[model samples]
Target: MLFYRAALPLSRKTLTFVAGIIRRHRASIGSCWRKLNPGQQALLVLAHLRKGETLAELAAGFGVGVTTAWRYVNETVALLAARAPKLRRAVRDAKKAGYAYVVVDGTLIPIDRVAADRPFYSGKHKKHGMNLQVIASPGGDILWVSGALPGSVHDKKAEWIWGVLAELEAAGLVTLADKGYLGSTYAKIPYRGKNKPESQKQANKAHAKLRAPAERANAQLKNWRILRKLRCCPWRAGQLAKAIHVLQIREA
Candidate 1:
């Protein structure tokens, strides 16, 4: 797990967003009266997700049972994830905003070592993790995030498996990507062939500059330390990623 001596705080905007979600959900499906209010429940969940606080620590700090703490965190994560936009909707908004292209990238979120299954092992990172695909606007706004896939999976395969590339093509949106997606249609990948002309070299440099936003978007997501190295079940990673993505969009 990624641990820091001093905990990070969630932004006011994020708190407001979480509060609104909790309020609506409480109205729809009321939770039993408890010591923690909606605001405290939201904060407890955020502390786990953003500050990388352990379940035991959170439970002790909040004076609740460990199981109750876990329940609050997981329930809030599900609510936030439900608000995340789909790929097609995000791309349509980008098109409406007159964006020329969207950038695509993948990230490896480290997780606790699993003994039995080797599927989560990433040869590239030399760790057990999950691969998450991100699509971002040119200005560094995250547009969509794909569900978690095994880290052994390549970025291109993840894109194809999630129908991201096909959806981008069908939407007629230009995509900017790195060499990993060289053969993907409708994506402007950097020049890779040897003995390229000066023009191609310049184009490659320009491509790198344009692709920085996607990298920044990836960094922003990982700044939430729970994602820095997940200590929980691998199956829960996707839900956490989606929840964080929604909070990010709301903050933006």
Candidate 2:
């Protein structure tokens, strides 16, 4: 056996919070016994997510079989993902936060490879990945992350599929987005097709400025390391994203 040390820059509060979730989950499931306790299991999942540690290394370090480690990660991720807010709840949160408008953005979660080629290929990014739409406050705080869609889905279409614009509008909220959302009523985007008036150009500049800060929401997510590129099933990408969303919200 080989042993080594690695760092996971998460706080003890994060570990304890996750452990509580798993503890209740185990009791609910009537899980009588396990090789690792709730805290250990939480730590293992956090390591995999924050440090991007592979299942093999985690299994070796924790003295568990690879399958057990895989099961722990999946179970914890699913539990966390289930706690993530829905579109309606998210908008209501924005309302409570006294936000008149929210920033909308989309990102690709890269995958090593997939069962299909064209379906997973993002023409815009020129890569294979999953598309996740994010909603952020004006201050760049992430409020929601939509379910994963095929990378081929346009940002405009993905947001439409999530019906975020309609939800926000119904909540009396506005949306600030990029050119991809140009055709929508609420998505305020930059001007199109060159040779515009100075006023229009100035408006576009302001739009870009407003949208720039929201980009941090994407950074907040990808900083977790696991989201930088998913080594797991592409179908699980949304679950992991939602899981991260829940953790980020609670940890904040």
Candidate 3:
């Protein structure tokens, strides 16, 4: 097959940063030589995550075996994921950033069917995917991204299970979210029930105005193509999300 050149819309700083991580990881592991150097390995992983390149295509382009390509992608993803901020740290960061509030939201990262398929199916989305909880600043900056849970988990349950509510309560930050988070202990969600007083309706209108930025945050995360859908194992979804989270923070 003929090899062709391609482009990724990433800045040089992002590429250099990824290469640095690979360099340090190799030093820590005392790794031997590989089919690709740290820069090449970083490129391979970034291409896979950013462009959703297939394993066969990546392997062929990089001049390595498919297994080697897979290994590199997984290794680099784990390295980046380890750097993603945890929830508590994220909230403290928002406080330091002088933001009045943070926004909590969740999204479905669609995935291919696995052997144990039942749990990954979401009745709401009518598909198989992973649930990713994202916490963002008022300015729509991503502060944290939680590990993957099965798609079947409701948005409310997913947040609760991840201790989002408890953490926000402890932090005492004003948190904005959609109706999916209505029952949260600390987050402020829109009003429900068919018959609402004029004041509740006005409250929802104002709430929606404030929460528009959160939708942008979700779009930003999905901007990384690999997250659109996962052809890899379902278990890898969390690592993939976290990896992208780190990359996005670097990008922003």
Candidate 4:
């Protein structure tokens, strides 16, 4: 007879860790319990998110309609937002562990044509969808993410960068960004200048002198293919932000 290995049960150490987290923020998940079978809903939502499955794909996978899948995603997003403090705490812990410098940038995600009516802009090639701005630590862990903005909006004006600066300033941390955010007074050291190659190079060098760590961090974020390709829609932009944050935390 062939023998198969059985998976081990969750250890007490892991269970206790999760229990403690839940105990501290039980209220966040309370709404979820009243709305759906929290455990099943959470597992289904996380599975689809982790797989990067589109709404249609999720619908087909779970034998549900696309609208149902969308509803699930929306609810899950709300639940997560309710617990955003936990996410912020995770970022803070990572920063406390020697990850100080931060990188700020924006990317666009493509959406379906139906969503085009909402808000977007036409670029050289494809229609730009939503813009996702992120603030990540030098180690690439996302500290906080802002909601999506219309593609036509300037990167500097995106809520992720400008709207959150006051909170970050209160925390006493410097943020770094590209020329788009040049005029931002909140950045401890803003890097901006004319478009001339020599001028750009000089500005970069000056920025490095002020904060070399943040410059290095931005270089790493741009290395990601998704960031290189601006094609995410407003809805997917939220998922992408969560996905990136989860990945960063795991990698950190």
lDDT of 4 by residue, 121-239 (tens): 73522565666666766655456666666677777677444465555555566666665665677764443445758766776786655454534443443443344443334465655
lDDT of 1 by residue, 1-252 (tens): 343345446678788779778878888876668777888888889889887989898888877899989988988999999888888887788788888888989889998986556899988788889999998988888888889998889888999998887888888888999987867867889988899999999999999998996678988888889999998888788889889999887777
Model 4: colliding residue pairs:
108-232, 109-231, 109-232, 109-233, 110-231, 110-232, 110-233
What would the per-residue lDDT of candidate 3 be over residues 1-252, giving only the tens digit for each residue?
998889998988888999999999999989998879999999998999999999899999989999999889988998999998988898787777888888888889999886468899988889999999988887788888888999999999998889987887787788888988766767888989999999999999999888887668888878889989888787788888888889988887
Q: Estimate each model's TM-score.
A: 0.92, 0.96, 0.95, 0.58
Better of 1 and 2 by TM-score: 2
Task: Mark the 10 consecutive residues where model 1 has the least summed lDDT.
Answer: 1-10
* lDDT by residue (tens digit), candidate 2, 1-252: 769887788888889999999999999989999999999999999999987889999999998999999999999999999999999999998999998679999999998885567898999999999999999998888899998998999999999899989998898877898887878977778889879999999998888888888789999899888999988888888899899888887778
Alpha-carbon local distance difference test for all models: 0.85, 0.90, 0.87, 0.53
Better of 3 and 4 by TM-score: 3
- Please give the TM-score that candidate 3 achieves against the real structure: 0.95
Q: Rank the candidates by lDDT, best first.
A: 2, 3, 1, 4
Name the candidate that leads on TM-score. 2
* lDDT pick, better of 3 and 4: 3
The window of 10 residues in a row where model 3 has the poorest summed lDDT is 179-188
lDDT for model 1, please. Answer: 0.85
Can you tell me which runs of candidate 3 are displaced by over 4 Å?
A: 114-116
